[model samples]
Target: MGCDGGTIPKRHELVKGPKKVEKVDKNAELAAKWKYCALSQEKLRRPIVACELGRLYNKDAVIEYLLDKSAERPNVEVVAHIRGMKDVKVLNLTDNPAWEGERRNAKGDCYEDMHCAMFICPVVGLEMNGKHKFCYLQTCGCVFSDRALREVKTEICHKCGDPFQDEDIVVLNGSKEELEKLQKTMEERRAKAKTGKKSKKSKGVETVSKPSEAKVSSESKPGLTNGESGGDSSSSDSVPGPSSSSKTAKPITAAGSKRSIQQMEEKSEAYKSLFTSHSSAKRTKDQLSNWVTHTPYHF
Candidate 1:
């Protein structure tokens, strides 16, 4: 079969064995996860954010995705759990001193380093180039390598010194199993928040109805007292409420019920004199101005 028809038989064409599974390149996979936005698939720029699953994304890209959720997106599964901006945290990245960024090799005299990253761990100084395991604190959003976290044990963040718990540490570019665990935690948190909001709303409604209930009780008690005998009126008035006692007390004055200002002993004599109602403020007949006839000689 090999020499038939003066044709060459390639090794691939003759092989009828089971197909070999193709493996993804580790370097390319790392670059995709660490150096690019998970949502838009663009190069990671300033104002980078991370979701609950520790996936990195550009802030603007995340905003656009949130704004137009109905639009078709290839990487929707990555950000499907993200509800809004509150679902993500902005990373506080540390700049790498050796990284030249876009103008890395302008002279072209030296070999370019493909593993170079713009940000690195402030504690261990490891480049965030996927070679090292990195995690960020949810409390402070400070990125640090896993090695540094294990070496230096503390509740305070290494970069910002913000106190955090074990639950606050989220792994960056984690495995599929880790991502699923993070997703489950995120769902539980949102559900807890929803229950809290509902409880607050119920409390608010109960408080608002209390004032109206008191008003109804106060109004009904007076009507019941009017319908009963004299002996029962006193017992009916004892229905305890906020304003029932104040409403039941009748004003004894027949007419001119206004209290006299002179009865107020707390006022100073000078302060009382400023008012026209004071005895001192009333003018005598001698101090009053007389009405005069208009004449040029009078001036």
Candidate 2:
């Protein structure tokens, strides 16, 4: 068959192979985690703090989040568990001796050290550059590699010499399983502390209530007796029987010979009007003057 001006296509152009996947650089990933803040994703600076969950963050970023949580942020979920400044501990990291930060830049160095670390483990000579697993002590804020702790096992802290348990050790940038385990331990410790406080409060309440209950019972008995006696006396006085009526009819005289000053005043003309014996009577001049001045006036 005779073909026109069009030519046939090659087999390689017609048939396509699988797409190649882009590989992530391990050095960059490790540097990002260890050398940058987890919350702000900025280069790690001084005053670095770590949360209870072992996540590193910048102190200024944490303070800003605390001041106004509603402010817009890049990664807000990273610090959701941080309630206040108390939730994080200021880390005391050791500076690496080999790090020439400003000098290296001024020299225009072409060599990039992948193993160079910003902070080094005091226990072992391991760099915190993400190749080895690292952890921090919550009690003393000391950072150490997992291998160092496993090799030299001790109950006290390697730096501070403070005693600590397994619960005090928290892994930095840990995997999902490690974080879950740490969370479980933290919750259990808090529950134990809460239960202890509740037990103490309950005991104090019981001790206090027992004495008050006893006092109330003891006082109520005397009050009830006094009330009953008073009621009986009042009831007897209310009934106008022969004996009760005669007793009430008798005049009460506290003293036998001495007369009260009120009896002397009752015989006076000024007090006689008080009993309604005289009506529409005007007071004399002497009485009016004495009433106005409240003292006798000399003529």
Candidate 3:
């Protein structure tokens, strides 16, 4: 065949192949989870905090988000459940001894350690680089590897020596299954707390009701006794004959009657002296004649 205007096809160009699948780097993924804040995606610094779901965050970043949740943020969905500071616990991380933070970044230092860790497990000496499972105590905030805690098997904290229960231990950056289990446990604890409050309230109501009931019964008994005694006295007094009743009724009417003016004057000598009905001293006949003349005309 005659040669065409197009260039010759190479062996590699003629071969058809499937698109390559992009794979995430293990080291980079681990670094993102452990050394960076889950919410802000910044380098982890002091005053780091963790949520109940084991997501890590910077304390300042969380505070800023809480202050103005309506503000635009890069990863707002990551902290949608975080309402306030109570949802997060500040970590008390142990600094790694091998870390040379500022000195390693010096201009003169030729060799830099890429695998340096900022914090480590105090008991197992494991770097917190997402390779091993880690957990923190809610009571003390001390962190340790899961393996170390299982091996040691003590109720007291390895670093602070404070006593702790299984309920107090919270996993950091746990898997989905672990997070679900933690949520269930939290719900159960809250339910128990509510039940306890209800029981106390019921007990208080019972105590108050009992005293009031006793007072009502005691007061009712005295009223009944007084009523019975008064009724008995009234019945006994009513048993008299009609003649005796008439005689008693006549005296009651006489005692309650109003006195006449003549009877009142006869009862008291002081009242009789106020009027001239029985006066020993009388006006003279000449004084009466003068009183009649003085009334008609003045001299």
TM-score for every candidate vs. truth?
Answer: 0.72, 0.65, 0.64
Candidate 2 segments whose C-alpha is farther than 4 A from its true place = 1-22, 193-211, 224-299
Tens-digit lDDT track for model 2 on 183-267?
7876787689889999999999999999999988755543343246576558657897699755433322321255643466557
Please write out the lDDT profile of model 1 over residues 1-299, one tens digit for every residue.
36688898888788798988999998899999999999899999989999889999999999999999999987998898888999899999999999888897889998988899999899889999998889998888999999999999999988777999988889999988998888788889889999999999999999999999998875555444354547655664777885765554442131226676666799888887777889987889999889876787876
| Candidate 3 deviant stretches above 4 angstroms | 1-19, 106-109, 197-222, 225-299
RMSD, one per candidate, in order: 9.3, 12.9, 16.9
Compared with the true structure, model 3 gives a TM-score of 0.64
- The clash count for each model shown is 0, 0, 0
Better of 1 and 2 by TM-score: 1
lDDT against the true structure, per candidate, is 0.86, 0.79, 0.82
- The TM-score between candidate 2 and the true structure equals 0.65
Best-fitting candidate, measured by lDDT?
1
lDDT of 2: 0.79
Query: Alpha-carbon error at 153 in model 1, in Å?
Result: 2.4
